[model samples]
Target: MLNIMELQQILPQEYPFLLIDRVLELDEGKRIVAIKNVTANEHFFVGHFPGLPVMPGVLILEAMAQTAIVLYAKTKHVDKNMVRYYFAKAEIKFKAPVVPGDVLQIEVEAEKMLSTGGILKAVASVEGKTVAESVIGFSVKNIREDKT
Candidate 1:
């Protein structure tokens, strides 16, 4: 189980963008489970819908990607700060709307581990019901900071 502080260290995202609130379970090279607590105060909720706010689909996908990055980082023993993780592709489907006060549980399982990254299967659920699911792909590459 990873707390928010540890997640912040592993993820490059910060407030308003950092979606995964906590990691419930992690199995290196295999799978991960995380959660995002959606609230009415989320910045996107203001514009996504003034009266009927729904969590954006893209953000949901991003949450899945973030969770996968944690798995990839652990499996490959890479320093997350030294590398960049990219969302390569996704075959996603939304089954329901995610609203404020919902605890979005995200689960990702490795489907195919690659040399540079890997393919993963992801799902987001609310109260034990699936709200979204996807097959996501990612790639990791070293971040070259100017040393000269």
Candidate 2:
């Protein structure tokens, strides 16, 4: 299992933006299982819904993407600083409202990988109930500090 700190080595997301909390399982290019602990203290809740806050569906997708990145990094053996992964597409379905105190389980499976692009299918669930699922298409590109 990889903790948040270790995950930071594979992903560029920071606080308030880092959606994945921990990685429960990882199999390089094949599959991964991650966790995201949604808390009422999340900043988005302030506007997402003032009183009855619900975890935004987009964030759930972000968590899934992060997990995919970890898998990619491990498989490619590339340092996070040397490369970056961008979401090419995301087809997501929100099935339930994710509230604070919910522990979201994110599972991702790599469907295909190529030099120019790749595809990953993922799902987020809470208490055995699916909250969201998405198939994300992404590409990997070299990172140049001065070119961004």
Alpha carbon lDDT of each predicted model: 0.90, 0.87
Total clashes for model 1:
0
Best by TM-score: 1
Cα lDDT tens digits for candidate 2, 15-38: 879999899998888999999998
Per-residue lDDT tens digits for candidate 1, residues 46-110, read: 89988899999999999999998888887887786788877879999999999999999999999
Best by lDDT: 1
Report clashes for each candidate as comma-separated counts: 0, 0
- What residue pairs are clashing in model 2? none
lDDT of 2 at 59: 83
Predict model 1's lDDT versus the native: 0.90
